[model samples]
Target: MSEIGATPDPGEIKDKIKAGSDRANALKAYVDTVSIKHVHRQDIEMIDLVVKTYELLTEIMKLVESKVDEIGNAKK
Candidate 1:
């Protein structure tokens, strides 16, 4: 735990988010390559939802990294 008035580390935050993004990307790859012999309508819908969610997550990750960079710049 950080002490009172301690500033949080932006690098640590970015690293953690990047790690999660990497895992998400790996799962996306699996989703892209998995073979479904008999894909149902529901399966298709779910896959579509996942793809959209991933796109949004990608945007969010970019936003976070941008914010981190901004903070670092402000500190400099």
Candidate 2:
């Protein structure tokens, strides 16, 4: 293409590219934080496994609340 009547400013183009990269990096980091890729087998009975998993989830919820509190405190 050779219709070079007007072109985007180089600095603007560079800034846009940098902004896109920054957004991509932030998204990747967020995804990494939530990605779980390991599942090890535990030889517990099904009912016991369900109860234990539920308990573990409760504990994790408490931990998540504490983290949110800390982050909120930091923001203030």
Top candidate on lDDT is 1
| TM-score, one value per model | 0.85, 0.41
lDDT (tens digit, per residue) of candidate 2 on 1-76: 2247854344454455556555655654554464244433442344345555555655655565566556656666
Candidate 1: C-alpha RMSD to true structure equals: 2.0
The clash numbers for all candidates, in the given order, read 0, 0
What tens-digit string does per-residue lDDT give for candidate 1 at 1-76? 4467887688887888899899889879978985677888788789889889988999999999899889988999
CA lDDT, candidate 1, residue 5: 85
Candidate 1: C-alpha lDDT: 0.85
Error of 1 at 10 (Å): 1.2
Cα lDDT computed for each candidate against the true fold: 0.85, 0.51
Segments of candidate 2 deviating more than 4 angstroms: 1-44
Displacement of residue 45 (Cα, Å) in model 1 is 0.6
